[model samples]
Target: MEETVANFSGSNGPDNISGTPGADFIIGLDGNDTLFGLGGHDRIVGSGGLDFLVGGDGLDTIFGEDGDDTIQGSAGADRLSGGTGADRIFGGDDGDLVFGDEGNDTIGGDDGNDTLNAGDGDDRVLGGDGDDEMFGGGNADLLRGGLGNDLAFGETGNDTVFGDAGNDRLKGNEGDDSVNGGTGNDSIFGDEGHDTLRGDDGNDKIWGGDNNDVLYGEGGQDILWGNDGTDSLSGGDGNDQAYGGGGSDSLYGDAGDDSLYGDAGNDQLFAGDGNDLAFGGAGDDFFQGHDGNDTLKGQDGNDTMFGGTGLDLLLGGAGNDTLAGNEDADLLRGEAGDDDLNGGSGDDYLNGGTGEDQVTGGAGNDSIYGEEDADRLVGGDGDDFVRGGAGDDVVLGNEGNDTLRGDDGNDALIGGADDDMLSGGNGNDELQGGDGDDTLLGGDGNDTLSGGEGNNELTGGEGADQFNFDGGITTIVDLDLDLDVLDTSSVLGLDTALSILGSTTVVGADLDILGGDGSLLTLKDVTILDFADFLGIDIDLLNSDLGIISG
Candidate 1:
């Protein structure tokens, strides 16, 4: 290692040459050579064969033109290349441009914001620090766009990639491999394996290329797709949008107001938080709206869905599905098939759009509508409004003040708690008002009305109707004794006719003192177990009446 100008112009053999002290130029011509640029700002070239080039200091350029070569840029802003063969190139210290051209290679743009190019074959490239750009050309390659906001290209073949820091983009053109969008808002693509990709931070968009893949949007708002095959996707935080493009896939909106879709196949989706929108298009899908206000739909197949929290809206588009609104005010619809829908709490709206469905409004004020088929609806608590449309149906207003309507067909409407309203529109129906002051109307059928307690009004419209009374004050306002019958089984414990009172009709305002709950059965009909039985009299007449009869 002395001060000299050593230039091997025709060293056709494998040569080992070293440059020293001064500004030296060491060149290796042909054969496999070892060229070291030690002191001065040196220029070392491994012209041919499998060569090793080392740039010691100062601004240097080392070219491994042929064969599988290794080049190390020790302490300078260097330009290193493994020209043709499978090579290893290292950029030490300062900014460097390292390229592994042609064969399978490994290139590292160590420190600084350097450029790393892995030209051909299956290669691995890394950008150490600062802003780096990694170019992966053809073949299966591993490219890491390291530190700072970096950019990496996994151009062609099955490759593995990592975008470590800052805002970066890692694109896998083809093949099955794993990729990570380390931090910052980064975009990553699983261009083709059943690949695995993660967008670690910042709002990022990731796409999975044809085949089964796993994708994760770790934090921030992200967009992910399980493009094909049976894939899995997770939207970790912030608002995210995920779509299961095809096949039987699973999508999860872990947090934030995220929107998720199970595009095809038998899929599953979880809308974690924030107001989210989810649609499971086609096939039997399972969807759950975990928290926040969410909109979910199981487009086809016999699906099962749950509206987990907040005010949620769920639709079971087709097939027989089991849909439930776990908490808060929710709107649940079982669009088709013989379905079941349950609204868990708060004020909820439930619609059994079609098919023979069983629906329940768990708590709070609820509105339930059974559009078609023989449906069953029950309102759990609070004042509820229930409508049973078409077919023979049964509806119950379980608690609080409620309103129930039997639109068509032979239907049964039962009211529970507080004051309630029950209406039987057509067909032979039954309307039973359980407690408090209630109103029961038999619209246009040979219907039966029963008022359980408190003051109530019952109307039998256009038919041979029958009225049953249990207790309290019940007013049979529109009871045509010519076409209607009063069944007082509640007092007599058996059916008894209106003639039992014997024409002594006590009109509303002309009422006098009667025993029991101080009740006036009605201005017209006072049927059922009357106060006369409690007073130990078979006939009804007051002591003030002149020809009053006593049993």
Candidate 2:
């Protein structure tokens, strides 16, 4: 039964006491008691058994001093503490200080600038308003910093922490924990064990300290650091910057123009949307720029990068890397080490920098450079421009009207199909125009130029070069009569140079080969006497068909 008390001192039995509107004092000194401080500044204490205490109005002080208790500071700026046993505490109105001392407890600072200390045991605390500070003490706890600028620390144990709706600072100190920075600009840390940290809104800063961890920058322009261990970090929205420090980590820039750094170990970095930048530092890493114009750098190991969609720039620094510009006009540089690069679709620029590398310009008009070492460059479709710089390189213009340049070393340049231009710059190089009305330039050294099919134009720039002609109308320009020779071994079935001179017939200014299945070799600015003097043979011996003529 409920009893009205001016000063109630109960026995070792269950008691219910209510206080008057004036200044009152009530103490339920033993059994499970129920006390209410209805008005004025009152003091209520449940000194022994399991009790229910409520500070209903003005400035009040409520204590759950003994057994398991339920305490509520319902109105004014009150001070409440759940002492000893497991308790549920709520500071329901003004600025209050709530203590969940001993045993496992649940605390709620429902309004005002509250201070909640979940001392000892596994506790759960929610700091509901004003600028609040919460501490999750002992065991695994869940702390929510609700509203206002709050501070939350999951001290010890594996805890779960949330900085909800305020500019807050949250830390999961020690154990493997999960922390979220919700709403306003916040700072979060997962200190020690493997943790999961998320920056759910506003421009926040998150760190996953020690062990293997995962972090997500869910909104705003945030910064995330996955320090130590093999970690995974994602920048979920806005222009965020994420760093994967140490171990083999994975970093994702999920939206906006983000920057992701895979610092150390073999990592995977993805720039998902917006114009992003990603760095694969140390170890062999993988990077993908899924949409937007991104820039990806593979700084130390043998990394692989793909520019999926927009115009991206990929740099493979220091390792044998593989880079693919998956769509649009992108730029890829395989700087140092032996690398492989592909410019998929769009007009891209690819540089196979240093070591022996392989590069392909897939579709669109791309520009490919095989810089240093013996590299292979293929311009696949569209009108591409390919340069094989230094070493014994191979350059292939796979399709369209492409241009292939073999710069230095004994390089081979091939125009795969259509009308392409092949230049063998320096060294004893080989140039082949596979189809269409192609142009082949054998630049410097003892070079060989072959017009594979269609009506081709072949130019031998310097040194003693050889020009091979086949079934089509082959036009030879700047061909030295004394130093360069025409190779008609495939058309005339004659391997020796004397047999080629004996099988040529000059019809006007062109030398017609009779046994090439109607193949015509057009020698520009050269007559029958000029060809005969260069061959150092009788002019009639070169003019005679020897029963191998048509028409």
Which candidate ranks first by lDDT, i.e. highest? 2
Per-residue lDDT tens digits of candidate 2, residues 84-163?
99999999888888999998999999989898999999999999988888999889999999889999999989999989
TM per prediction: 0.78, 0.85
Worst 10 residues of 1 by lDDT: 493-502
Model 1's TM-score against the true structure: 0.78
lDDT of 2 at 341: 93
Predicted candidate 1 versus true structure: per-residue lDDT over 145-240, tens digit per residue: 778888887777777889988889787776777889988889788876678899988888899888889999998989998888899999998889
CA RMSD for every model? 6.6, 5.3
Q: How far is candidate 1 from the true structure (C-alpha RMSD, Å)?
A: 6.6
lDDT of each: 0.82, 0.85
Number of the top-ranking candidate, with TM-score as the measure: 2
